[model samples]
Target chain A: MNYLFDLNAFLPGVIAGVAGLIALLIDSYKNDHDGIYGLTVVSLIAALGLSIIDMFGPVGEAWSGMITYGGVSAFGNTVVLLGALFCVLISREYLKAIEHEFGEVYAMVLIATSGMLALASANNLIMIFVGLETMSICLYVLAGLIKEHKIGAEAALKYFLLGAFSTGFLLYGMALLYGATGSLSIPEIAQNASSNLLFIAGAGLLLVGFFFKVSAVPFHMWTPDVYQGTPTTLTAYMATASKSATFVALILIVSKMLPAETAEWSEVLEVIAIITMILGNIIALVQDNIKRMLAYSSIAHAGYLLVGLAAGTPEGYSAVLFYLLAYTIMNVGAFGIVAYYERQQGLDFTDVNNYAGLGFKRPIMGVMLSIFLFSLAGIPPLVGFFGKYLVFAAAINADMIALAVIGVLASAASVYYYLRPMVYMYFREPHKDVPFVQAGITFKGTLIVLTILTIYFGVAFGGLHDLLASYYSGDWVTHLTGN
Target chain B: MISIDWYLALSAILFCIGIVGVLIRKNAIVIFMCVELMLNAVNLSLVSFSSHYGNVDGQILVFFSLAIAAAEAVVGLAIIIAIFRNNFSVDITQINLLRW
Candidate 1:
């Protein structure tokens, strides 16, 4: 509550806000659009630089309670910054194609990234809700930003309604927990494990709210529609950055408050994981549109992450983090290629049939997408395989044999759908009229970097895991859960 | 004088009403109203707890939540306007863009 100025804690947000305001001004002028875009990108890079410094460099311990910067928060921040960069990398081309380019888009994205940074470091419930709303409000507008498209409008509205509903649930749960325990701080709630009926009710409702936020089954009905309706670039942003942040918040909640008492929640979560995996993979099999297919694929991946979570161990938690990191690379690359083609084709959905003979026409885009698909299917020596492997291994180690078995079956079933587009792309006759468009330099450069990272992580798992293990060994629960 | 249990029971009933509204109402706006109701129910309980513990932290939180709820409502309405333009109706049942 002190009004003392520490420029460090407030600097990133201020920079992002100023950059966003400048972008809005430039867009209003309707000139120097490229300059505006450049400014936005530079702002995000600056923020990314600060986050890395906070992670690796020694920031004074003054703001530890407000915004801690140890290994786990640093890891989450690094992934989120990567997402922002990917958005910035794709912005010049994607925004240019829509012909209504504005700097506000990039600015808002960076600001949201900052909010997520705070959310990850939130030591209390109040900061968490503030962070959640700041992030969500920007996204609602971003989702519906394409004014000309009815689909965009529909997606935005649906997302807003459902997101607000979930927020309500989340807030109510927080309040009830406060009521039951007479505390609102997460550390306080975690330690005071009163088994009163009110406490149990609050916990139960809070689980539902978190499940909705992560888009777990029984509460995930909104994901596919929203994903399909939003712009492809925005969809990629949601699939990677937003999902990563939410899961980080979710894992913190579960581990900090419900570790020893996991038996109360694990039973319900196990059922959710099983249904989410099966339904997501099965529905994806019938999708002809590549984006929609990826939407379902992301859902199935969520279920796989849940399998790690259900195990409730450090190995399980780190395994989820590793998998999310891998998913970010593969999914972003996949969507990047789609965004590339949409620009060239003068605005068209990337359907599976359209990709037939694409391998011959646009070898680079086609091959990159194939790698992403294979990885998603959990093929060996790909990033996706290791992500799923870690989660499954964690599951077995936790002795959740049946859940691990079902997870494997779900991944196997996923192969059929993930590979379907590859079949159309590589094996079938080429579609002659729609030649693959030459990607702009920025787009191509980003794709190459993403592809390399995807493969490198897939192959060199031991080192990355070891580094992550050493860096991320401290458990928030031991301190929070003990009275 | 109303006992603490009375306040708790009243909050529970309000929460249940919100749940029923979400399950039964087809109008997106109405469903949103129900969500607000649920949040209020939680706030009522929080206020009661603040009194019980003789601390104002929980009460201060209720204010913060109220601000957030107001913002959420504004955004929700804006989105509904966009959707109403797209579908020409506010009925959730009619907005099924995802059909197998």
Candidate 2:
């Protein structure tokens, strides 16, 4: 247990944190939004590049086993950084349109991204708690970015109250786990994993906390409100990046900390996945608000990811990683388009009926939104379809045929809701003459990049899937599980 | 000497009370306090566990949790105040402008 200062292992998070502080200092002194924004984007891109490089580097624990770097953690960091980059890229135009382009927003986003980075690689319960709270507190403020808007205020309050409440459960669970295992480190907990009452109770509470963060069913009441009320671009950030980071942490817990001999936890996950899928899709079917609908859709996507977790195999875990990357790209694109429309009229522009004839009005955005929605619906030749395919394939391979069948059916049901906006955009006549909203070159460029990635990854998902799967195979498995 | 079980039991009871308060309370401030209580309860348990194990990790975790709770309270109160200024009320039941 040599406590070496492994700067390389923590560099991505360090870059973002230092950049956030600099952004904050700049904001306090000068109030320069553009400079702050540029700084944020450059720092995030550098962090993303470093994380990608780390994925191919040697897998090891660092900071005296409080953090793990390379392999899966690096992949998680890359996904989170990618989500943050896209959100920040598109946020400038949207925030300016809303007349609230504060430099502080950029600082908060960077800080939150750094917290997510910490969470992704967190090997200790203390790191997880601190990382999760840092991210949540910033998000609470971001949710209420417009304090004057009643809905925004309401969203922040609800998010804060619920988020804090969940933190209590999470902390208590961590305490119990520490007591049961006599250690706060994840690998140590795994080595001492047991099916005792305290251990099971702690695991259940931890699951509740993760489920709330991920917005799974029953714990999902906060999603629609928070997503709808938050500024659209930051909503995209919250929905994709934060969820990816938490899911990565949950994956670590499920794979490492839980006793493999117990079928109880898997059964519990299967049930939650079933309910999250059915309810999320069914409720989304009737939503008129595009942001709210995407909220429910995100919940449904979480269910599909949970299906992979329930499969309880290395294949299932890697499938989850692949699905997360695919999910991040398509979701940010979907929400990015929503932000585009949202900033145009400011409030009430997000309703699906308002999208009528919008396809013809702005053909490029219309086409890009279509690509993202289709990908989300798991259509062929898009990354989302491959993501769904890999997850269900992993489930089937693990002999969870019932779970796979239910997942396929739920996703098939999801296609209807995902296509609702497209139907209104292309097929229906415009009830009101809404003018086309002009988007900046960078905003359009980001969407275009996302669209190409969606299609390109769909067609060539094999290589990425193999790469992710390799992270969970052979020596990497022993390294990750600390065997 | 009080066994560690006594501390764990007391902590569990306090946590349950806090959860109940959060679930039933309407005033946003009270709910926030209830959350703080829940956190304090966890802190108690962590401290007891640290002493029981004769290691500093659990105590260190308690410190982090305490710092996090204070940060959370600051944000939560600011949010509650912001919502109050808009709606002129801190009652959770009345803050329903974005319902499903």
Candidate 3:
């Protein structure tokens, strides 16, 4: 492989950084944050356009194979950017309501997004480390951006400590991998697998790090606190886009670099997937706080995504992509509603009981949130159902009958907790007036678009699956052959 | 007469100590420092590998990791200060405002 610095592969990330810098430079003199906010959104849309355009172009190598384009990585970046776009949409109003509407939010979000874009397409282990750190540091600051809140401050500290520790494990794993293989590129490392205990241990440690980032079982201690501690809008962004990017990087490595040891990884993924699903759902059942509940639900959803990974087939890979697309929309919408409610009542108004008779009092919030909840529960005629269906099908296709059965049982158990909010919203008598702020066009637009997408993908799921198939044949397959 | 294995072994030991510090330490800043220690150990190992293989990639990667570690420390300290402002302490136990 030759080393050449190609700018095309870095275009999306570059544009994002440029946008962030523009926001910061203008923010100091603009007096009001309106200009900064407008510029930030415009640049985000521009980056989104670049990602879409790159999808159709021929796959290319950039930075001497440190990053790849026009395949799963490209599609993954597109999804991450779109998720960030929705986050910005909902965030504009939430920040304003909380009196934290500053240029830093826009700049930090863009910086974190560029990092995610880098991580999504990274081709080398070194690039992955840099990307992860860039994304995580921004997230730590974003989580604690509301410094006046004790919980926000506390949450940031815990997340910073735990996240850095996990990153240590990741760096050590990369070092061991380099020691074992004498290379940093995924393709080169794959070709040089030595089947030594050292290599196995390195890979295992790497999985531990990845699992921590994606909030898998046993390594998920910080997730609930971090999710509940961050301001609702930032939490929404973290739970969806950041988690998806981490999984994309994980899937890329598991599929691209570890095909030689798929058997070894499949066993590990299978066990973790089952435990993650069961434990996440079971624990969610006991949480009274809505944010905490959704945190565990997000973990369970990660488990379902892992089932697609454990299948270890092309079909499974596409299923993971499709599930991520569906899951992002629904999760963002769910968290948007949480933020809206938290803003209306108080920052600490997170108890499910507070939502009693909320459906009758505030029909719009109730209906929209119910739609998100039902989608999360994997109910029919919603994107989450289709996402779950595809992953379960992939598991069964791989002859993993037990895994599929367990996935089904876990989904069944999850319905209770998922409906807990709905029960308080509709079935119970009104405890207090559940008036919500409904003035921001950005907030309303985000809900409207996400609701349409949730139902649109749910009903016309075939269109996406077909498009994914074409993409698989057109770009990813060619890139693999070229490699 | 130190071979590459000696460097690897020494780095590995330092890495383990860092991990223990992160797990066992209660002071937020100390744990944060331990994380930096772990990252430095990795840098040491990477440098050793680069020299043994006579490739510039690992050395280049060490530079990237060093920069990232510094960036991380800046962010970590900022967050610790924010926590300290809110609670007047950086002890992990004292910062427990979120539980589920």
Say which candidate scores most in TM-score.
Answer: 2
Summed over model 1, clashes come to: 0
Clashing pairs in 3: none
The interface RMSD value for candidate 2 stands at: 0.7
- The TM-score measured for candidate 1 stands at 0.92
Residue A185 of model 2 has an lDDT of: 96
Q: State the weakest 10-residue window (summed lDDT) of model 3 chain A.
A: A1-10
**lDDT (tens digit, per residue) of candidate 2 on A1-483:** 443458778999999999999999999999788899999999999999999999999888998888999999999999999999999999999999999889989999999999999999999999999999999999999999989989899999999999999999999999989888899999889888888888888888888999999999999999999998899999999999999999999999898888666437888988999999999999999998989999999999999999999988899899999999999999999999988888776336788988888899889899999999999999999999999998999889988899999999989999998888999899999887755578999999999999999999999887888889888889746654654
Name model 1 segments beyond 4 Å from true. Answer: A1-18, A21-32, A57-64, A346-348, A471-483
DockQ for all models, in order?
A: 0.60, 0.92, 0.85
lDDT per residue, candidate 3, A313-382, as tens digits?
7788889999999889999999998888888754246889888887887788789999999999999999
lDDT of 1 by residue, A1-483 (tens): 443444465455556667777777777787776787788789878876876666654433224354545465666766777887886788668877767466677767866776776676566777677777777877887887775567777787778877877877777777778887788777678778677776777777777776776778888888887888777887888788877877777776777666465245766677889999998988998988888888889999999999988887778888988888898888888888887776666325467787777677788788998888898899989889999999999989988999999999989999998888889878999655654456789988998899898889988889768755665454435553443
Docking class of 1: medium
